[model samples]
Target: MTSLLKQPVVDAINGQVVEEFTASLQYTAIALYFDSETLPQLSGFFHLQAQEEHMHAMKLLNYITEAGGQPIVPATKPVKNHFESVEEAVALALNQELKVTEQINSLVSVAVRENDYLTQQFLQWFVTEQLEEVSSMSDLLNIVRRAGKDLFRIEDWLVQNPHEAAAGGAA
Candidate 1:
């Protein structure tokens, strides 16, 4: 199939696929951390996050294929497996979300520069998605910080706020 996306845009999306998969692995690491700590709610939250990130990667891959571009499923970069504190882990997640927001914005810029309306429209979902991702991670970080030594509070918050447990994906 002839590629609908220019080379630059295709390259950018492939890079984003790596980022998304890396995020999934990072979240899985965090979930393992929480599980070891015996915080089921927190662990479950990150497990859900990991699945969402994997889905995000798959979405980009599908978009690339549908656009007639050869989708490259590159290996993800290494992720931090250990974290000192709950706040530290949550902070890391928020930071990752922020970085991904920048990446998605860059993708949009590339589409705009190339005048690829189709690619630009296709990426709008991710553009809007970043807003929710960043916001949810930020909120989780705040809660973790405020809970301080009371880590159970964070778990309780996750329980009380079920939608938040799903990382803003729930209705």
Candidate 2:
């Protein structure tokens, strides 16, 4: 079938796919760091986060394929494997999510420019997802701040508030 997605839109979505995968890899690195530090609970949280990111990428990949566009995989820079603390790691996550949000918005703007209603509609889901991701990451970082060198307290809080913590392993 002829592709409903324009080449530029396909390129943009493929870029998102790369960004999502990069996030997954970064989360994996963070999880490994947490595990090595003997913070199994935190590690598990990041592991779940990594899986979610991978899922996000796969969603985009499938969407592009379904639209009959050729999906391109881009090369990514190395993910940072070392973080001084949980706060640092969570902060990095927030920053990355924010960046991804920006990219998604840009794609929406492009769809608007091209008058591609279907692509614009498709991107709305990503807009909402990014909002949730940003909100969750910020909340987790805030919890870390409140815990303030008492990571175990954060862990306990996550246990008490499993839904809030479950996004990236806050639970």
TM-score of each: 0.97, 0.93
lDDT: worst 10-residue window of model 2: 162-171
Candidate that scores best on lDDT? 1
RMSD to true structure for each model, in Å: 1.1, 2.3
Instruction: Tell me the whole-model lDDT of each prediction, alpha carbons only.
Output: 0.91, 0.85
Give the Å error, residue 151, model 1.
1.1
The whole-model C-alpha lDDT of candidate 1 against the native structure comes to: 0.91
lDDT of 1 by residue, 1-171 (tens): 888889999999999999999999999999999999999998998999999999999999999999899999998899999899888898999999999999999999999999999988888888888888898889988888889899889989999998877754642
Write candidate 2's Cα lDDT for 1-171 as tens digits: 899988888888898898899999999999899899887777877888899888888888898899999987678658999899999998998899999999999989888888889989988888888877898888888888999988898777767776765753321
Residue-pair clashes per candidate: 0, 3
- Backbone clashes in candidate 1 total 0
